[model samples]
Target chain A: MTGAACVLGVDSGGSGLRAALGSPEGAPCAGPVRSAEPVRTGPRGIDAGHFMDLLLPLARDLLAASGGGRIAAVAVGAAGMATLGEGLRAELPGALGRELGAERVALAADAVTAYAGALGERPGAVVAAGTGLIAVGTDLAAWRRADGWGHLLGDCGSGAWIGRAGLEAAMRAHDGRRGGSPALRDRAEKVFGPAAGLPGQLYPRADRPAVLASFAPEVAACAAGDAVAGGILRDAARHVAEAAAAVCPRDAASEVALTGGLIKLGEPLLGPLRDDLAELLPHARQVPAAGDPLDGALRIAGGLAADRLLLPRDARMLSVHRSEGPSTSA
Target chain B: MTGAACVLGVDSGGSGLRAALGSPEGAPCAGPVRSAEPVRTGPRGIDAGHFMDLLLPLARDLLAASGGGRIAAVAVGAAGMATLGEGLRAELPGALGRELGAERVALAADAVTAYAGALGERPGAVVAAGTGLIAVGTDLAAWRRADGWGHLLGDCGSGAWIGRAGLEAAMRAHDGRRGGSPALRDRAEKVFGPAAGLPGQLYPRADRPAVLASFAPEVAACAAGDAVAGGILRDAARHVAEAAAAVCPRDAASEVALTGGLIKLGEPLLGPLRDDLAELLPHARQVPAAGDPLDGALRIAGGLAADRLLLPRDARMLSVHRSEGPSTSA
Candidate 1:
């Protein structure tokens, strides 16, 4: 009954939000996800009430679609919480809290889930380069984080980074500083205006990340022909590879997983990333994650991979737990 | 007699503001200037009201000190207006508009004035690497600009940029990702707090530019020993030099003028800048500006170097003028 007690997983990302329902071994149901902000639990602080308000609706929608059967467990993989653990535990603001059953709900950062989904709780690094970029790695001895210092400081090889680089190059070309693609110019004009007044057109806008991300595809498309765009993609790849290498180190690594929207750019981004990874860290091989972060979330929720969670030992209670139905008799 | 046809020069910079009153020949009387914003006219757009408020008092004070001299002309050299020859004419919100006689006043961008002050109307590139960085060069035939893309996109060699890099390095160090100076952490703590949470402690601050700029000295000081800090400074120098090289091409060069508060850090910034310029553009040699931006502004106002003024052909009337008494014959 109820397909042997299915598990639910949620991914809260900058680009979109997705909920996965069903057994990890079977075809999980996901999607019609909404793009929204991740959990706001940090030094600036998170609001648990607000977090529940945003998540419950999405969860209920998924549950309603699941044949109205009994629910087993729930897991969440969120960007804000994704490499959380280290010193960030005490500062975490009741992440996911007891809004659900409190016993069957588990919360892990997006990187951990990506790691679990990609490498199955193994020791290695995983780079999630989407609208944002961050590389989190564990060699089972030391934890290392590379880049993902947000969009302003580092985030070297992210889609946003690539988009920004492309836009800057386009602006430079327009200002007669360099040669750029007309198509690139068109893309800029489409978003930033035909006058090409970049700073005025870009900085003040609230959706700067999204605006920049929209240009990422243009950069990837232009990489085949345009030198500037091509160069940007190559640089992005190098940065991404370097980030992965920064975490994995020499002796304690195996698989480096590359995930997120930018990975879907295919050859333009991956080709160079792979080349750079070989040069930067030969021991760690780049591998496709075996499952989505949702799968990793499910694994953590179902107690299938509890050890895979990356929280500090004192803060295992940080994950939210909820239980229901005959399968997970909490 | 109102001081025998004197002119006023204003230097509005990231660090402080200065107004000069003296004859056109020698160094004009300057200082007691408040650090303030420049002309409010750029693609990203800037505010000039703050500049006027800060300047009017300084100008009034200088006028008072001048013993009521006949102000023949006034010139302003401001960062915001440094590259403002484009579509920012009508939008300039009363920079020297009515605070003084608008006609006799000549407003030139800081980079052009920097070029004049350093090279005296000579065809060359001038790099202003203060809290903000922008390089403008004139080959007598065409005008070219490099970098100065603002803190978000470019301004690669600027003090603000360097400080940001240094802070990022500090964050990495605190996170156990990299080795950094305890002094660096101390500086960050002083500014951001002992919590040392970067983005949360930072991004929301109102005076981010000033805060970032304050760390530049620490970066310069650490250049001699700390690898990370040293790396940041070297990169800064290279970027600054590259900006100069970008604007001033090979054949059309006179000399590259390096001027700014950051330049005061001496060889740490200048050494690598010179080296990079040598490699990047062999024709350009680094030189100290012949005079300060005040001198350049004076030159522009007295119309001694009208061609040096980097304003649109149609709207050179942005500068302010106040004439009285016998010398000016107003």
Candidate 2:
């Protein structure tokens, strides 16, 4: 069934989900895709079926706007898909077919799409560092991940990780338990002011990692030679390098592609991370992602259609299915 | 004139001003001295004259409870005054004489008492690390200070400084700009919740630094082996050592004392700081204050009266000044 074939891609994260349609170049679809309220993914991330339930109606609305033309395919790249394995892989395709009346559905981790978008569905690794840090790689059909231990046990090379480190320094400096770096001390007081005392006030609520993660750039400035702040960046880079190395598979063609907010520390962190990773994996190739993860998902859909492994409408339907597959209301 | 004479020591921080009366053995005076709202010192750390203005009346109140007997003499060690010259120092005596009707008033920086509290008023240095940091030394009639830059330019080894450092690290981690310790991020999320993403909420509040400062122990913990956190503490300890060495005149004769909330980091920071200082000045002496700074002030007052410099009624009037000075006005 192919009539003005359409494809949809959705990228959901801790805060919200973003969906787009059309070709890999960010071309607009013939119709509109509906959006819904942001659902709290919790500490473990979002549930796939529940995510599909939320997205299906929105996908239908978009397809219905296509003036009665059948949707070709649907694909989704979401934040929490890494936590799901084979037992859950079929959940998405089944839900999308049932909910959106689609002919074909493609299920893959958001990291897969991110990898695809950044370097196309090729052989490489993607470091998805947002509120947290996780390194993912694809060796054709096999997928591997490392360092997504949330904000507590792991996530050494993430925004949250850096933020948490910064907070500890500030606390020590503020109490005079430790001598403070001029740069780090200045940034904390500039943002929080002098009256910011009392340990409990530093974290009266939850989601502190996100709060601390917000100051990543400030630390970058310090790391760029501001004596007090430079160490923070230097240390953070080391953590990221460890994470990337942890996920690199032995005897695989490893092309490391960096993603996420923490890389903004630029040279101070990135340069060191590169040097360290090279020391560990002498033959590891560093690849920069060209586009976002959703684009990678779309590219995958396009390639499938081109290869006839999936039909044009099948690809379009799969794309639409991805947008609506996570929240399939039970 | 002397009817069971007692000494009262007052410590005024940004949070609150508390007065305590007791002996060097840690026994409470016949009655509690007094306490009041935190007097705004206005950054440059409260001038000697202004301190007298607020303190004299409080002294009188405390003295009045002595029941018409002498308070022996009054000694006040404030956060500032170490940098004040003879002219500024003279004004304090006049202010106390006129305001509280005292014959003797000894005005100096809390560093003096902090040091004395740590080393019994002998020649030594006290690292006064509270909301701010000050390294002070005393040699007979002269006093010297260094590294108490308040919250703005200096305060290298202070609670405010550490809090600021932690915040910057967390921000970098949040934005994915750098990897950081897991502390500030988690702590911040706990304090601010969803609003933790909003940096403004973590700053410029009464409890921000106080809350952040509470993590001094964490910095110490991390410094012991927490990698990212250890770096923060080591950096701070170095700063504190530099500040201490800078203020202490002769390294051979200098006794370094540690005070303030930062000291709670215990041996983690202190041990490293001592080692660092040893490298800078092998003969530099280190010790914890025998008690709080206010207690040292009382001891100084007792010593002054024992030497017959102040009449008995002078002490009584100082007590009256603290308790009845404000109320007698209207």
- Which candidate leads in lDDT? 1
Question: What is the TM-score (0 to 1) of candidate 2?
Answer: 0.56
DockQ measured for candidate 1: 0.32
Model 2 residue A173 CA deviation in Å: 13
* Model 2: chain A TM-score against the true structure: 0.78
List, for all models, the DockQ compared with the true complex: 0.32, 0.04
**CA lDDT of A123 in candidate 1?**
79
Model 1 Cα lDDT, one tens digit per residue, B103-213: 355666677677667776567788877788878787665667776777766777688888888887776555444344566766677777762367665666666666677
Interface RMSD of 1: 3.3
Q: Model 2's DockQ?
A: 0.04
lDDT of 2 by residue, B73-140 (tens): 46666554443323335455555444544444565466666766676656656787866777766543
How many backbone clashes does every candidate have?
22, 130
Per-candidate iRMSD: 3.3, 11.2
Cα displacement (Å) at residue A170, model 1: 3.3
Q: Give the DockQ-based CAPRI class for model 1.
A: acceptable
